[model samples]
Target chain A: MNDARRHHDMGGLEAGAIDRGEHDKAPWEKRVDALMVLLGQRKILCVDELRRGIEELGADAYERYGYYERWMASMTNILLEKKIIEVGELGARMAEIESGRREALR
Target chain B: MSRHEHTGGPAHAHGHDGYDADPTHRHPPRPDLEDTPLAYHQVMQMAVVSLLVEKGVVSADDMRAQIERMDALTPARGARLVARAWVDGGFRERLLADSKAAAAELGIDLGPIPILVMENTPETHNLVVCTLCSCYPRFLLGLPPDWYKSRSYRSRAVREPRRVLAEFGTDLDPDSRIRVHDSTADMRYMILPMRPAGTEGMSEEALARLVTRDSLIGVAVPRAG
Candidate 1:
């Protein structure tokens, strides 16, 4: 895809440029930087694994992650093994929390 | 020829994906992508890895010598703060009042976006999304999941969270309410999951274990049993 198409496909760069007061950086790129930092910190597992987590994840981490399946799973597995996640448990709690959030919105 | 499994599930013959259609079993890598050099990216990666190691947050010798290819795997700094909140009510109050200060207390400095921590009370459920995309607080949490940024999740989460939750394998009862928050502007969130019952006086590590990454993200609940 061309730069314009790529930019559009990722998410609008126009909004990013306006928001940052500079050239727009794609959302996926920012996520990549965050993952690198996490790897550096030894807080997570491997780089590829982090990318996988980004793919499988359904919620925002620092900012957001674009669809990159293989990479996200790798990250999820490593983080899961590292005890950085509570896995099946956290999902259940988030549902309960959302209930209250819905009321506030109404 | 069509491959068939004894269990009755449709299957593929020969090198057709794995038994379960898992990619890990089939066509592992494309040669072209594998042959490409990543020297420059690796160098940049090393700089980040070194920074974290120097800080002593992660040991240098414990894991691999070099930081391999990276991705946003787990929830970032935000989860840590939520864990802290689970133990210390006073700190939790401070966090909800001023996320930046609370984060600083834990040595996490979130620049620009003055982080604001939100508590998920019994009456309100908070789900964050960047309607345009996914905007999370990585300063507290580590990274977001892949599904978070998908077109379906981003679009549906704000308008129809109950539906989204069900899709994510969280089936809530009809009587239970659901709320979703779109994370926009400078404000970012780290969910304060309700303290689980039991373990009235567990140690910090034990409690931290219960405070899973998903709970802080407002997706899952703490494990009580």
Candidate 2:
């Protein structure tokens, strides 16, 4: 197999039948979309940068994560690389939100 | 494996029957209502929004407004263009020549990327796909559907579009040619399907009602009402 194609370069392959059933979009997904739009609108990150981040996600994670999940990962990575949002602050915020969510559920 | 189940034999149960045609639906319940813990991405999304708003890079109000602007857009915008092209050949020529200006005439801003319009005639049908990730004409046709972003479609659209179209219940004539347009980040595409016969004398608004999102994607053709 002398294949040189990248993981996300699935232009033509033996992929199976398409799933026609449309799933209900989650609110989080819309927020992720809005985040991208805002980021783009502010000239903080371009769509090309997002595409590159997605391409860098390797085969397994690319296949595993949902569409917007991959988008979140890529955007976060780009923001981190750009120094727009530091990893420590982001992790701390996520942990705080997680605990608050757990408290509410409990 | 496959991402979604192949609910075959279709007039497109999910959307085209009413979605792209009518542009109205209910979204799923918010994740907060669910008893399970927040997903990793959901947490990240919240954190990202909070950080952006706190840092003044973008306001929460502006974020909401941006989403609303996108939410307000629908396939009707593209349908109106298709219907206008159906009734006027001059408009069609202008559309195929410069889609952005044509869409602008209709008060639709197609954004920075150039979205090319491919007209479908009796001899040829055009299909749109984004193999290298979903590079769709979002501002023109609203958000790309899940199936449009599916790995199966991304892979097969350029390879076996005829079979894929058949899955959408669009069986083309044996002699008719099918052209697949793979959209990139720099350029986007949408199919201007042939006007169904016997649609004469109908107002443009009435004709626009017949254009489905699937048809605009070249998987199906609008039917005469």
Candidate 3:
């Protein structure tokens, strides 16, 4: 982690190959993108807050996820921080969905 | 009783969710979860949006409208502007003077983000990068390509612009200075690449076809064919 510059700062760092292939956006990714724009347009959250949330993601998660994944994580964290949704509720809902998927698989 | 296995073998005989019996059983890598159709982060995003809707933070209609608005924008708008500027010197002057107004004249809505048109001359080549983040003129050019947001492009574009441009197959004169614009502020930048040689009589519409998205981003120039 280059602490001298912020985590989001990527200027002048050595990085790997640039994948130029264009892939279609997944459905969930599209919805998440729209949700972010809607939230911004409605004044529910600002771009700066979103950027800060993304920047605050620990080094591990930051390097692990893709661009949209980071955005989704940042938006989720911001919502949780603002008390829009409780952590327990979010976790329970996720678990419920996971079990539902397991049931479908079985 | 490992967290991972349930067959009741010696791995599960101790009944501690199988993890304790095998200290080597590390948590599944996180990237695997993202490969699934509905990634965990996507689910979390859905949950957050659902809760926000239920709490009256934003309506479903608002989201739909925003999605529609984004869908309506594409790089063709930028192509049209570049093509027009190429055929008309006066329009090019106006475009460089006030990009927003020029875009408006060409029926392109640039949204709230201010756009600055950086012309690429023989003496100076222009490249755009948001060193702080992936900030491009989305209103006109649409969402940036994956490489534009990559850590490599963002970092290398500003540090060694000529080398970066070379990677994109855009080799410039060694003596021509390269100006890398780090779009760290509210304003977004677009490169107005010089028109390629030949086809002097080509229509503006025909010329627009040569203006690839990469050219608008300054990674490559508009090719003539």
Fnat for each predicted structure, in order: 0.01, 0.72, 0.58
Interface CA RMSD of each prediction in angstroms: 18.9, 4.1, 8.0
State residue B166's C-alpha deviation in candidate 1, in Å.
2.4
Scoring each candidate complex against the real one, what DockQ results?
0.03, 0.59, 0.38
lDDT of 1 by residue, B1-225 (tens): 001011122223323211223445442212111122322222223333344355554555433332222222245455567778878889999989988888789886765566666677666666666664456766556455545555555555656666665554555657656666667555776777777778688776666767766666666667765
lDDT of 3 at B162: 83
- Please, what are the lDDT tens digits per residue for candidate 2 over residues A46-100? 9899989988998988887888888999999999999999999999999999999
Predictions in order: lDDT: 0.51, 0.84, 0.77
Model 2 DockQ reads: 0.59
Q: A1-106, model 1: which lDDT tens digit per residue?
A: 4533422124322221011011111223343355545564554464334534554443442233223322344444554477555456434444444454456546
Better of 2 and 3 by TM-score: 2
Best by TM-score: 2
lDDT of 3 by residue, B1-225 (tens): 111112112222232211133334342212222222445676677677777788898888887787678767788889999999999999999999999899889878888988999999999899999888788999988778767887778878888888788888889999999888899989999889999999599999999999988998998998898
List TM-score per model, in order. Answer: 0.50, 0.90, 0.85
Best by DockQ: 2
Report residue A26 deviation for candidate 3 (angstroms).
Answer: 1.7
lDDT of 2: 0.84
True contacts kept of 1: 0.01
Tell me which of candidates 1 and 2 scores higher on lDDT. 2
What docking tier does model 2 reach? medium
